[model samples]
Target: MAKFPKNFLWGGATSANQIEGTFLEQGKGWSTADIDKFIPKEQRKSGPADNLVKRADVEFAMHDKKGIYPKRNGIDFYHHYKEDIALLAEAGFKMFRISISWPRIFPNGDDKEPNEEGLRFYDKVFDECRKKKIEPLVTLSHFEMPLNLVLKQNGWLSRKTVDDFVHYADVVFNRYKNKVRYWITFNEINVLEMSGFTSGGILADNIANRKEARYQAAHHQFVASALAVKKCHEIIPNASIGAMIARFESYPKTCNPKDALANVRANQNNLFFSDVQIRGYYPSYIKRFFKDNDIHLKINDGDKKILREGTADFLAFSYYSSMVAISPDATEGEKLTSGNLKLSFQNPYLRSNDWGWQFDPIGLRIALNELYDRYQVPLFVVENGLGAKDKLSKDNRIHDDYRIDYLKQHIEQIGEAYQDGVEIMGYLIWGCIDLVSASSCEMSKRYGIVYVDLDDYGKGTLKRKKKDSYYWYKKVVESNGLIL
Candidate 1:
């Protein structure tokens, strides 16, 4: 197998909502993440909370007093950031990915002023990262939006929110411009296409057309992202700003030509997000998609110019599993599997994690090559890790060989991609330390090498301990993929 480069970035990633507790402390306002309550065991079978469906869901989440909101109480990273950074530094981390909570910076989305306490908090965190000699990769927004925006301006659905987000972007960009060199404008920005409130704080039922409103809101975000890119370049000339995507590569379930065609369509849909940001324009295929779906976007006077001028410097993405795509048939019964966003059939040959999510390390290599050959930009794997129900042994230690194996195979594939001439900037594990789950809002689905002493219902000491994978990863990083 090929070796990792000398300057390969090896680190961990955690979003503010996933790790930082004290959701309301220091004048921080409520985000969409904050309002996502935990479902009890009885209700979990029905599924996780379906928040942000309407105004009522927002009001209920905001007003519910006795609900078990686990996100509000994460691993208490707000208090343990220093210790966490030091541990990673001990493991020789070259980078650490974290998102600055927008609601923390600006209590309300449209506020004229930002919270100084929130600014001071991140200042301490970034300084700690820099002190450890670890470069910081900061995401402006990651699956979070100020709930106030939804109440006032319907989030990104309104042009006003676009300006508000840009203003928020300007404040943070200027504030941390010296500290942070690698910036992501929005985390999984394309998630807005399917999830409205989670990304954009949009309520579809309140709108006339759900699809139209979603795309229109996406247009607003595209413009906002472009404007942020332009501003970041102007403010921090040395910084590189990238656009992130939730890229789950699709596979044809069979050798049939029809299945291949269907797979092609699914893959194009996934690539559409990156194309707009990296290429600085939407592809013809997506325009055809918009026409076929009757999505007539309202292009403003200078929107096209902004998009053209604000292309991304690099492409960052999260790839966990490969999805199977097959032609729609009236007769064939499908064996479906867990997917990131879209529905798909299972790959019978691939192994699965405890969550039943199929794994394909080779698909990661293919994804890297496809992205490199198409965009020709530096790629950063910002999210790639295994989430399982990690159990603490009697000795109070975790021996997660399965996670290590999963990462080992995937890193080997990434190494192969590097040898294939793909310019990989770095690789960051999704959850370096255990925190709240974005899906179930539970600690049971643990993904961190550093385990947190916290339970699903906000119980436990909130302590941190390293697992076996921690030492293994340190060796892998120190060897620069030579040992793995």
Candidate 2:
């Protein structure tokens, strides 16, 4: 019955930009997330092809009136914080995973002073969470940068961005030191390597040699993350700061060693982010990777010391599903499949959602066991959920048994992983309430157990209602995960 810890945290997670609307209110300035426009099916060049953001798109989004920018006016969590927290608490949630918008505090990312109104807003949020006995798992940055930084500083591509981020981290760490205890330095830090503009705001098309810019920006982030960890420890004194990444663990396409080797290298490419944050140094494999790829990163003075000394206290990751890896030489006529952030050969044995995200709940157990064995630190499943379309019946109810099944199966794998001796921290389902989709920028790809009556075009009553999964999750959390 003790499959999960007595103190196991059962909760739902959402980033500020994803859930909070009123992007410019409370003294909050615009951020990178504010610029993401929803692309209709007809307009999409390909599946997530618009992932590579360009400077022109950024420029257009700033002034474009016709585009449907959902993030700018998310589910309105900005004004509904109390009500939303109440709903989550009513479902017996012990934790509420949320992120503080960096631009909200420092409008320009390098502002000499923080916007007091922005800090005051989260004060009420944390207070409500405290009143409801819901712990706040705060992420420092979640795919958001100040628009000013993107335009002027080139996001994380400039080392100066590191100092700006550290100062912002320090401000929040000191301000929320008492209100919040859990911290994640960056959400999906590895995304910078591939989706530079989205993750780091480098404006992908402007870079001539993208590989060099990506790593150089990644190096800056590595230093900033480490420095943030160090500052968190110095200021919070009792808080646990960790690193977060988009965890993509894949299998080889065939029994061939070539496929296996390709899979190993690909996994390392993703794991390299956490290695620097958790292990406090670069893996030996990365030296060959940089040299072979002709990517040179500028590592300045004392950066290594900061990394070595400021290792994360834990590892947080998002694992929605696993992919199959095949050697480039073996790509004869194999069908390719889309995944979280990578493409690979689709596995015939797996079933996919409407978004083509293959489901392998059993893969969750395998991933947890591997991560625990590798790092031996407490691991948190910060983001894992099925994004499927939900229907609202006329009775003012949403019978989303599909979502209940998705969560139940994944929770089962988590239990198996716990029995296998993984030091599990907790599980937080992504998008606990329906909000803008991070990849496609659509609200229809709902992942929440609680339904938000908003559509892709941002038309809705804006009312919140519980889905069938909500009561199901209440029982699971009430029993400390034993009921499931």
Candidate number of the best lDDT: 2
Candidate 1 off by > 4 Å: 45-52, 330-332
User: What is the per-residue lDDT of model 2 for residues 1-484, given as tens digits with 9 covering 90 to 100?
Assistant: 5468889999999998899999788888889999888889677765433445677878999999998999999999998999999999999999999999998999989999999999999999999999999999999999998999988878889999999999999899889989999999889999887788788888776677787898898889989999998889889889998999988878998899999999999889889999888899889999998898888888998989989998999999998888888898988898877778666678999988887788889999999999999999999999999898888889968898878888889999999999999999999989999889987789999999889989999999899988988899999999988887
Error of 2 at 327 (Å): 1.1
Best by TM-score: 2
Position 376, candidate 2: lDDT: 92
Candidate 1: lDDT of 182?
92
- TM-scores for the candidates: 0.97, 0.98
Report every candidate's CA lDDT: 0.87, 0.89
